[model samples]
Target: MVKKIASIFGTNMAEPKGETAADRAYRILRSAILSGRLPTDRKVTEAGLAEMLDLSRTPVRNAVGRLLIEGLLQRRKGSGLWCILPTRDEIRTIFDIRARLESYAAARAAEFATPLQRAELVASAARMALLVDEMLSDPHADVVPRIDAENALFHCKIVEAAHARRLELLLQSTIDVNLVTLTLQAYGTEQRMRSASHHHEIAVAIAGGMVELAGKAMEVHILSAASFVLTDPQADHPAPRQGKMPVRPG
Candidate 1:
C-alpha cells in the first residue's frame, strides 16, 4: 500500500532550505499524526519510519523521541509507537485545566505584557482570522497548518507575557498538539470564526490592560473549545484503519 506524503505535509518530502533532516522528519510525521493521516491504531517504529521517509535511522530516531516527549506518540506494552487518543473525559479535563491556567495567563499578560508583545498577539490573532476566512472560502486549500501555527504563536505570546515560568511548564503538559489539530479540523465555519473572534477579543483586552476582561475572555474562549469538542459530532477522533501505509515519500 502507498500513501502520498504530500497529502500530509502539503508538499513532497524534500527538506526545505535551512531545515535539517531531523526537523524535516519531525515536521512530516507531526503533520501526519496530528492531521489523523496516521490512524490511531497504526503502529510505527523509528526504523520503519526512516525507511519510509527515505532518511537514515538517526534523524528518524530523533524525531520519534521528540514526539514521544510531546505526548503525541505513545508506546504500548506489546506495540511500538502509536498516536495517542484521549478519552472524552480526558479531553474535557485537559480543556478545563487549560481554561484556568490560560485565563490567569491572559490576565497577567494584560498587566505585564510589553508593548511589542501585545502587538504580536494582535497580529497573530488577525492572521488566524484571515486564514479562517480563506479556509471558509476555499475549502480545498491546505492552510490548516498555517492557521494552527498562528494559533500556537498567539497562545505562546500570551504565556510569555505572563512571566510565570511554572505556568508555562504546566501548559506544556496540558496542551495536546495532536488533539488541538484534530479539534481545529473538526471545527465548522461558525466555530472557526468564533474562535478567531475570541483570539482577537483576548488580544485586544490584554493590549488595553483590561485584566479582568482579558481573563474572562480567555476563560470563555477555552470553555467554548470544550463545548465544541463535547457536542460536535465530528469531534470524536481516533478512527482505526487496517493496512500498511506508504513506504516512500510522495
Candidate 2:
C-alpha cells in the first residue's frame, strides 16, 4: 500500500510534530485530492484512511467531516466517502473567477513587489519551466505532480507579493479546491508546456515592472487553462447550480 500510494502521490507524510492527528490527516488527504492521487469516484472508508495514516479512526473521521463540509469530499450512498471531482462547467467557472482575481494580483505584484520578492518569483518560475521541460523530454516521467506543486508555489508568490489578504483568501480556496490543480494535470504535454511558458511570461512581466502586461499575461494564463477544461469529457459533473463560481461546493 505504501509503495502504491507513493507511486501515485510521489511521497508520504512525515508525521510532523506539534500538530494534532486530525490536522495531519486533513493535510495528507487534501494534497492527495489536489494532485488527483485519490481518484474522485473511489469510495474510501474511515478504517482504510486510518490504517493508511497509521492513526486511530477518530482523527480520520474528524478530517473526513471537515472535507465533507468544505465540499472537497462527498458522502457516498449508504455509508462511504469519495473525493469530489469538479465538473467541466465548475472548473471553467472557477477559472473565470480566478482570472478576475489573479490578473489584478499580477498587476499589484508588479506595482508592489520588492526586489527580493521579484527575485524569488522569477526563481520559482524558472523551476516550473524546468519541470515542464523535464516532463516533455521524458514522456513516462511522473513529473506531473511535481509541476503541480511548483505551480502552486509559483502563483502563491505572486499573491504574496501583491500583499492582498482578501485576494489571497479568495484565490487560495479556488486553487485548493482543485480548480487550478486539476486543470494543469488534465492538459496534454503541449498544453502543459504552454502553461509553463505562461508562468515564465508572468514572472517576466512582473519582473520587468510592466503592470498592465503582467495583468494581461495572468488573465491569458488562467483563461487558457479554463478553455482546456471546457473540452474535457470527464469534467462532466452535473452543471453546478447557477453561479459565477461555486465558492462552496459539494
Candidate 3:
C-alpha cells in the first residue's frame, strides 16, 4: 500500500520524523487529488484513508477537516466524505471571480512593482518558457505539476508586487483550488499550454509598467483559460464512477 501511494504520487517513501501525521496525510491526499489518482468526486472515508496511510483515524480526521475547509472535500449527511467536483455553473462563477481579481492585480502590479520585483517576474517567465519547451519535447514527463507550481509562484509574486495584503490573500486563497482543477483538465494539452504563455506575456507587460497592456493581457489570458475549461471535453466528461456526481458534457 505504501508503494502504491508512492507510485501514484511519483515519490519514494522516506523515514517518518517529527512532522505531524495530519500534515503527512494531507500532503499525500492533496497530491493524489491534484494528480487525478484519487479521481474527482470519489467517496472517501476516514477509515479507508487511515488504513491506506498506515496512520490512526485521528490524523486522517484532522486532514479531512482541513480539506473540507479548503473546499476540496465535501461531507454529505448520512453519506461520507467525497472529493468536491465543481459543477459547470460553479466553474463559471470561479472563473468570473478570478478574472476580476487577476485583472486588477495586473494593473496594480504595473503601477507598484519595484525594479527587483519586475526582474523576478521576468525570471519566472523565462523559467516557464524553459519548462514548456521541456514538456513539448517529452510529453510523458512529469512537467505538468512542475509547471503548475511555477505558474502559481509567478502569480504570487505578481500579487506581492501589487503590495495589497487584502488582495493578495484573497487571490492566494482561491489559487490552489482553481489550479488543481485547471491543471487536472488542461495540463497535457498543447492549446492550453500555448494559452498559458499569454499569461507570461502579461506578466512581462506588467513588469514593464504598461498598465493598459497588462490589464488587457490579463483579461485575455484569463478569459482564454476559462474558455478552454468550459469547452474541454476531458473536463466536461470525466470517467464514470459509482456513487459520485457525474460531470456534465460540454
- For each candidate, the alpha-carbon lDDT, in order, equals 0.77, 0.73, 0.68
Local accuracy of candidate 2 as per-residue lDDT tens digits, 1-250: 2222222222222344687989989978766666555655557777877877788989989999988886788987885787786666666677788788889999999999999989988898889889988887888999877787676667767888897887766664554354554555566788978888998899999999999999999999988877767876556642232222111111
RMSD of each: 6.7, 8.3, 7.4
Candidates sorted by lDDT, descending order?
Answer: 1, 2, 3
Pairs with steric clashes in candidate 1: none
After TM-score superposition, the amount by which residue 154's alpha carbon in candidate 2 deviates from its true location, in angstroms, is 1.1
Q: Model 3 over residues 1-250: C-alpha lDDT tens digits?
A: 3332222212323435576989898877765655455645457777877877788989988998888987778888977777765566766777787788888888899999999988888888888788888888888888866676566666667777788878866765655463444444454567546755886797789878998888788878777777777776655434332343222211
Query: Whose lDDT is greatest here?
Result: 1
TM-score of 3: 0.79
TM-score sort, best first: 3, 1, 2
Per-candidate TM-scores read 0.77, 0.75, 0.79
On TM-score, the leading prediction is: 3
Per-residue lDDT value at 45 in model 2: 73
RMSD of 2: 8.3
Instruction: Give the clash count for each candidate.
Output: 0, 1, 0
Error of 2 at 95 (Å): 1.1
- lDDT per residue for candidate 1 within 200-228, as digits (tens), equals 99999999999999999999998998898
